[model samples]
Target: MARIAVIGAGMGAMAGAARLAVAGHRVVVYERTQTYGGAVRGFERDGFRFDTGPGLLPLPAVWRDLFLKTGREPLESHVEAVQVDPSARHVFADGTEAALPNASRAGVVAALDTALGAGAGQRWGDFLVRARESWDRTRRPLLEEPLWPNWRVLAEREPYPAVPHKRLLRTRRAGTLAEIGAWELRDPRLAALLESHALAYGLDPRTTPASAAVLPYMEHAFGTWYVRGGMRELARAVYERCLARGVEFRFGTEVTAVVEKDGRAAGVELAGGEAAEADFVVAGVAPDVLDRVAGGLAERAAGEVPARRSAASRLTVLLALRGARPEGTAHRTVVHAPDRDAELASVFDGAPGPSARPTVTVLRPDDPALVPDAGHEAVVLSATVPAALGAAADPGSRSGDPAAGAEELITAATRAIPGLRDRLLWHEVRTPADIEAATGAAGGAVPAPALAAAGGRLLHPANGTRTPGLFTVGGWSHPGGGLPHAGMSGALVAGLIVEGPEFRGSQ
Candidate 1:
């Protein structure tokens, strides 16, 4: 059995370690912090807990498969996987509202039709049919397989089949997501709804490829889910599964460099001059950190890293409310910005000043595990923000007074929750600084999922590196970010290592 050294105890790294250990390899995980979940961490105070990372789980089958393969217990048994009905309630700038049902295209159509008008639902449904085509065409190449050597094909080709629009006797297909929304969906509210999906992932809809329609399609097809406690619990379960498989984890240990022997990865050198030798090494870190540890191996293996997009990191506000979470309230609500063009410009175009309003997603899960008591509610408000802001990089930043972006989030969330300011007991602002501290991403920039266009800006580096015996898994590698993509990265890396270079894809 080969000795494997996994860097960072993030979910992807841990998932890879569990499978490798079960494959009869001696695996040791090195994490810089005492925790194992990376960004999937939780915050608690005075008996109220909040998930500092993603609030909902999309494509839960990834984790379910992990639990089934790693142990006899099903994921449902370990954590209560509850389906969030009426997936999300959207409050548009014009005071129009629509509650989209979970995993039901027909229901979503009906709701949109009822709220936005008769034809709105049909248009969205037609768009989804095309998005499904994109999913089917790209699913195998993008998610199920390691990025092929000829990845440029994936970059050059557009899987989304955009309908040709004939305007003034000229026919053309939509390229960017904005064009799809403006020309195809054709309604301001629908455009906002579509663009919000891209924005949530730290992507600029104006430049992101039309293939991004798959984002909403995946959610509509797979449904939104919630663990009984929080997303952090999912991370806890994966970490425990690794432990059960005989994987050793060393906390508070930072890997300083990747030690190479005869042009192959030998092991990892730690902060205190300790070295753990291994037959293989798996790194689950951001691209920048990997480049630093491996001495520029990232750029050599992955080509030119894409420039940091302005709309990258997230600004989250965790509010402890004084009142109970009322019944019949949708678990998630999106308050759209009044001036979407202005907001998008401020975020993606780096305008001189912040937009007066910002789109905000308000999450109020009914799970009793989050609140101090029935009398109180735990609410989380989040918005996409520009990465690399100088103020967010300061180490001593505090949440005493909300920043401009945070204030916009608070103001937008009030549309979802009436009397929001009065109901708040206290609030905590988690900026890009906090995200950087937890996940080691530069500027705390969250990675977007791999996509087919935009000159390959949305694509991630291949899992198999130019360096022999060295591989990268997680959000920074092939298939890119988001919970499901990260999980798939683990599977792809494990498949390549176990089956050798001839491995084409997961069967």
Candidate 2:
């Protein structure tokens, strides 16, 4: 049996470890932090619990596949996967609100028709139809399989069948997401609803490819899910699965370097000045720090997806409220920014600044375990912010309150949560600084899922590298970020290792 050493105990790394161990390999995971799950972390105070990372999970089939491949126990047995009905409530800039049902095209169309007047729902439903086409075209290449060697083919092609819109002189199909909104959706509120899907993943709708329609399609088609208790439970479940597979984890043991022998990844060097030899190595850390730890490993590969220097980060405010959550409240609510242009300008990924108002996502799970009692509630508010102006990189961001974005988030949240400030007992703000500390991501910038078009700028590096026996997984690599994509990254890495370079796709 080959000995495998994995760097980082994130979900992706652990997922790979579990599958490799089940393949009868000896795997040891070294994590710098005292916990697993990378950015999937939780915070608790006075009976109130908050998931500091992703509040809801989309495309849970990825995890289901992981569980099925690794063990007999279904994912449902470990954590209660509750399908959130009325998937989400969106409050448009025009004060119009729509509650979309989970995974029901007819229900969502009807709801949008009722809320946005005639023709709006039809437009959105049609858009989703086109988005589905994109999903069917790219799903295997982007999510299920290792990134193709000729990835530019995926990059240059736009699978989204955009409707022909005649703009005065020329008749052309919409190219970017913004064009999809303006040419097809027509209504500003519908545009806001469409763009919010991209925004939630830190992608700028203005420039994101039309192929990104797959983002919302994945949610609408699959449905959003919440783990019982908190999202941290999902991380705990995966960590446990790795342990069950005999994967060894050394927490708080940081990896300093990726040692090489015969020009192949030989093992890893630890911070304590000890070397652990292994036959193969897998890295799940962010792309920014990957070079530092692995000595420019990604750069050695030819024509791999360029490492994303920076992406949008999130500013989250965890609220401990005094009152019980009202029954019938939607599981998730998105309050769109009142001034779209202004908010978009300020929240640009590389340029951090305060927006007068920015789009905010408010999550209030119905789970009683999150609160001390029925008399209290746990609420999480998240807003996309620039990757920089972080205390770690910007002098200005450090000069003022690092959590200054909390006020902006709270202000935008007032639309979703009535009397929000009044209901609060206390609140804690977690900035990009916290993310950088937790995940070692520069400026805590979160990577978005890989998208076709935009000349392949959004695609991440390939799973295999120039250095043999070394593979990179997680958000920084192929298939890109988000829970499902990261999990798939692990699967791809295992496939490449177990089946060798000829590995095509999971059966």
Candidate 3:
């Protein structure tokens, strides 16, 4: 078996290590931080525990596949997930609130029709049906396969021309979210709502790809879920599974560089000049950071790097509230701005001034066992903000003042939820700088490869020029970000490493 070195210890690295270990390969995961989990890390302040990253959990089957492949069961031991009803409460500028149901297309349509107006539901249903078809046709060929030779093979097996008459690839790169929604949905409110969904990827609807329409479909069709404990528990579960599979984990050991022998990667050089050898290396850190670590490898492979429409960087506040559950508050809430375009422009322009109002998603742990008391609440408010607000002098350094940013975020969040400030017992804030420092993510990108830029032939790193033994994996590669996609990226890389070029050749 190969001596593999998995870098970062994030979900992607963890998944890769676990899978490699189960395959009987000697695997060692080197993490720069004192802890694992990357973006999924959690912390506590006062009597409140907060999950620092990934507030929601969807697609449980993805986790199941990761565990089952390693001879484990995620459902039986890892997480207790409950499907959320009325998945999210979206609040508009006119004070109209739409509680979206986590149900079938017809059920969702009925709810939308009742909430919005007559005929709106059927219109949405038709759109959903089309989106579902897009998802079904492309999920395996586009998302499941590695973006390398496999993509080409899959394309050949089912040529875009031969596939169902739906214009999947044709619409791959179309108008912005708002434009598409405006043209597709007749109602202005529904169009705005559809456009606003782009915020889920930290993107503005105006520039977001139409393919992103699949996001709402997946959430509504499969349902939005929450872990019984917290999202961080998912990372812990993966960590435990890795240990069971005999994977060696070394935390607090930062990877300073990827050492190369001739033209291929030999291993990694840890902080303070310690070096560990491996026949294969999979880096699960951000692409920009990976570019730096690989010593311009990313720049050299610039053509391969998926084009990115700048992803929204967040300014998040974690609040510990002492009060009974607030009435009319769903597990998730989205507060829309009067002009989302201007709001998004301010963030992108690095002028996320003190006055910008952001959509807030509050998570109240349903499991009594996870929290100390029913009166206490753990709330995380996140909104898109300027990257400069969280900038640091060094990429690897921790934030200079996280508390200051936290205060600013808290002040903003209170505006959306009245009396929110008064209820806070303790709080923490995470700026883009803080997230990058803590998780080694590029520009605090929660998930690498922003949704807008990942599409068609460019989805996978394996498709581009490759060094003899050097390979890349993680969210930065392709299918793109999110926990499930990252895990799948690692698996795809592993398959390529083991099976050679033929693995993804049929894609």
Candidate 4:
């Protein structure tokens, strides 16, 4: 059995530690903060709680596989994952609404047809068929296996099969996601729906490859899920599972460096200069953090000096309300921006400032666990924003705080929540600064999940680094970010470590 040192107690690191321990290896995890879960965090006040990170989970099979591998207990037995039926309700700019069903393509089609009129549903349904092709073409190499040495092949090839469109007798296929929306979907509402998926992940639809269609396809196929209490409960279950498997954890202990010896990662150096020697070192941090901790060893292997990609952060406003959460309300609602083009330009290209009309996602779970009583409700409003590294937290600043972007979020969310301003008892803003302090990511940037194409810019570095025994896991590494991708990154890292360099992927 090998002695392994894992950095950070985030979901990805914990997943790896649990699996490694189950493989009979000794694993020790060092976390900078007194908590686990990384971005999957939650906040509680006076008996009310809100998930501060991702409010929902997609591709839960990732965690399910982890639990199955690490222990005999299934994930469902540890945490009650409730499928969010009518997965999400979308409120378009034109006062039109559609509630998409969870994991049912036909149902989604019917709902769209009913809400948006005839032909609209068929266009989206057809688009999904193409998206599925992208998923099938890329799933194995992108999510299941180790990133190939020549990752450029994946970057150069676009897996999404574009539909032929005849514009004035000339035939052309859609290249970017924006083209797919304009050429195929046609309707502005359908275009908005399609682009929203990419925007949520901090990708610019106009620039993102058509392969991104796989995103909506994945969600429609796998469905969205939520833990009974909050996403934090899932983290607690994973942490407990790690402990049950005999993996040791040290919270509030920051790892300063990856100790190297003879061109191999020997172990890690802690804040107080304490060294824990190991045969293998697993780092579950951002590329920037890895560059610092590993002394550029990781950056060299990644073929870049910094090894980090530009990331987008989130601006969230947690609302504590005095009214009961209405019964039969959809678990989540997306209020689309009034001006789609302007909104995209503001977020991706224009000066860092609040969008005059920003797209906002409103989350309000019906679980009583989130409210002080039957008379109260907890609502969370979130928007994608630029990550200004090392900046102070500005919650809806009056000084044109572009990074805050909270005011626009509030304005957009009003469409989703009735009498939102009236029921608001208190509100708290969670900014990028808070994320940086919590997760150690520069600028509190949240890395997007891996995509198939885009000249390799979207692909994460390989799990294995140049330095022998050194590996990168989590959102910043192979398979990229998001809860499911992070979990898969852990599995991939463990597979490489336990099965040797010849390891292809998880069995």
Candidate 5:
């Protein structure tokens, strides 16, 4: 069995390490941060706990599979998610509000019909059908395998007869959400609403690929769920499972390099000049950081990185409040911008000014145990911001400080939520720069790779290039990012590593 070393203690690293260890291979995970969950981790300030990233948890089966495969039961330790109704509230520019119900296509369609028009329901249904098809056609071939030739071979075997080279054409260009809405639905608001879903990835809908349109359908099909305590519990559960399976963890130990011998990965070198040897390595860190660690390999495989389609960075404000929860708000609420493009342009322009006034996503833990009392509330206000702007802001600025651009962001978020400023007990703002400094994510980006950049045949792991005894997982690798997708990517990589390179050649 291979002696594997997985870099980063994020879900991706844990998933990979668990699979490798369960397969009877020795595994060691090196995490740069003291915590286990990279972005999904939580911290407490003054009797209030906040999950720093990934507010929503969908596809529990993915996590279940990970735990089960590692010889652990997830539900036994962690809280089963409570499926939420009116999955999220989206407020349009025209002051109209709509609710996206949990796992109910008919409910979402009816809501859209009432908010938009009579035919809007049918239009949404049609869109759902297409997205479902896209998901079915793409899910296994793209998401379940390491980037290799098998995906292409499968596509060739299952091509649509009407379109002679449908699979080939599908991979050539990425479809934007706007393009999909315009081409299929012909409703700008509907298009904007669909595009707005790109916010989950921290991307502007205009630039995001149409394939992302599949996101809503996936949510509807699988449902939006909240873990009993908080999303952070999911990370803790996975980490514990890894420990149970004999996976070793090295927290707060940053990896400086991926050691290579004879053009193949041998192990990793830590920040303090320590080295650990391994037969295989899975990099759960940012692709750019991986590029740095791998030395000129990423440059050589520049085409593989999907140039000009990096995901957008974020500016987040976390608030701890006292008093009753706000009325007319679901567990999750999205305050939409009048013009998304204009708002995104400001972020891309690297200006210090507010971009689109920020999209406010308010989350109040349903469980009383998460906070001191029922009156206690926690909210996260996040918006896409230029990576450079965060770098320009002062790092030491505190709440209400004049130089803290983040403080201004918190003030703006408070305005969006009535009485929020007065209710605030404690608050902290995390700029993209803070995320970069804290987590070592390149440019503080959180897995927002453009769909267009990810659409091609090479996007699948089973069809991509590989170095002997080396595998890549997480958002930087094929099939792209998202908690579940990253976890699955790690599992697929373990399969590839265990099965040998000849298994890859078959496809």
Candidate 6:
């Protein structure tokens, strides 16, 4: 059995470590922090718990597969995953509301029709039909398997089938997500609804490829899931699974360098100058962080997809309220920004400042564990913001302070939570700085999932590098970010190490 050293105790790394141990490899996970679960962290105060990272899980099959592969117990046995019916409630800029059902295309169409208009639902339904095509075309290559050696093929081809629209007496097809919203959906609210999915991942819909349509399709088909006791519980389950499989974990022991021997990654160097030799190394970190591993530029294989530097991060505000969560409340609510153009410009293009008015996502899970008592509620408000926050370029706008962003989120949330400020007993704000401290990601920039177009700017570097006996697994590597993608990253790395380069994908 090969000896393996895995860096970071993040979900992806742990997933790999567990599977490697099951494969009879001696695996040791070295984490810089005192705990596991990279950004999938939690905060607790007076019985109130909040997920500091991703609040929900999509395509749970990724984690489920990990559990099934490592042990006889299923994922459901470890933690209860509750699907939020009326998948999400959307509050448009025009004050219209639509509560889409969980995994029910017909229900979503009906709800959109009731709220947006007669043909609104059908338009969205048809768009989803096209989005499914994108998913089918890219799923195996992007999520289920390794990044193809010919990844440029994924970059050059657009999987989304955009309907031809005649403009200025010439026939053209939608290229970017914005074009899809305008030409296909037509209604401004419908456009906003369609764009929200991309924005949630910190992608600028204005420039994101139409292939991103697969995003909503993923959620619509697989459904949104919330793990009981916050998302951190899921992390705990994975960490425990690793331990069960005899994978060792050394927390608070930072790996300072990757030790190379005979031009291969043989082991890792710790903070206090200790070295643990291993047959293989799995790094679960951002590409920028990985470059620092070998004391300089890590070796890159020829034609490997280059790393991307993202500027977007999330501003999360955890609210402790003095009221009980009302019944029949949507588990998640997205309050659309009043000024979508300015908001996108501030986050993706304009100055590094807090958005004047950002699109806010309000999460109110009806879980007793999240509240101090029946009389209390815990709410999380999040918005995409620049990784670097500074004074507003627009002097009159509220731009500099994270407090300003928190205020904007609260104001937008008022539409979702009645008397929000009045009910707010206390609040805590988490910025990208916190993310950097937690994940070692530069500028606390969160990576978006890989898409099929936009010239492959959205794709992450291949998990395999030029260095022998070394591989990468995390949001920053192939298949990109998000909980499901990260889990898949772990599986891919394990597959590569166990089955060699010939392993096409999971059967």
List the pairs of residues colliding in candidate 4: 353-402, 389-443
- TM-score of structure candidate 3: 0.86
- Write model 1 residue lDDT over 1-507, tens digit each, in one string: 999999999888888888888878899999999999888988999889999899999999888888877776689877898999989999999999999999999999999999999999999999999999999989877788988777778878888999899888999899989999988999999999999999999888888999999999999999999998999999988988898899999999999999999989999999989999999999998877887898754444435334233347788888999989999999999999899888887777777743547788999999889987999999998888766652354421122234655677888898999999999898888888788888888877888888886667778878877789999988878888889988888888888889898878766
lDDT of model 6 at position 134: 93
lDDT scores for all predictions? 0.85, 0.88, 0.66, 0.86, 0.67, 0.88
Candidate 3 weakest lDDT stretch, 10 residues: 157-166
Backbone clashes (count) for model 4: 2
Q: Backbone clashes in each candidate structure, one number apiece?
A: 0, 0, 11, 2, 16, 0
For candidate 4, report its TM-score: 0.96
Off by more than 4 A, model 5: 150-175, 297-311, 326-329, 349-354, 393-416, 449-466, 502-507
| Candidate 1 minimal-lDDT segment of 10 residues | 393-402
Among all windows of 10 consecutive residues in model 4, the one with the lowest summed lDDT is 395-404
- Residue 428 lDDT, candidate 2, scale 0-100: 89
lDDT string, candidate 2, 1-507, tens digits: 999999998878888999999999999999999999998999999988999999899999899988989997789989999999989999988899999999999999999999999989999999999999999999999998998989999989999999999988999998888899999999999899889988888888889999999998999999999999999999999999999999999999999999989889999999989999999999999876788888765464556677875557878889999988999999999999888887777767333444457789999999999999999989999888766645454311222354456777787888998898899889988888888889999877888898888889988888999889889988888888899999999999999999999999876
Point out where model 1 deviates above 4 Å: 301-311, 390-402
Model 5 per-residue lDDT tens digits across residues 1-507 = 778988888777788788888999999998877878877867677777777778788777778788777785665455667887778877666767777888988888899899888998778877887778767765665566555443334423321111112343463222566666666677867776777677757666665555666677678799988887788888888888889889999888888988888978899899989999998877777766777787554332533434222446666667788886655557876766666666666655444444445555656556665677778877776666555443444332212122354564565555346787788887777766766765567557666521323335324232123466667677666666677777777777777777765443112
lDDT-sorted candidate list, best first: 6, 2, 4, 1, 5, 3
Off by over 4 Å in 3: 149-174, 296-303, 306-311, 326-329, 349-355, 392-418, 448-460, 463-465, 505-507
Q: In candidate 4, how many Å is residue 315 off? A: 0.5
Each prediction's RMSD over C-alphas, in Å, is: 2.1, 1.7, 4.9, 1.9, 5.0, 2.3
In candidate 4, what are the lDDT values of residues 74-108, reduced to their tens digit?
99999999999989999999999999999998998
Better candidate by TM-score, 3 or 6: 6
- TM-score against truth, every candidate: 0.96, 0.97, 0.86, 0.96, 0.86, 0.97
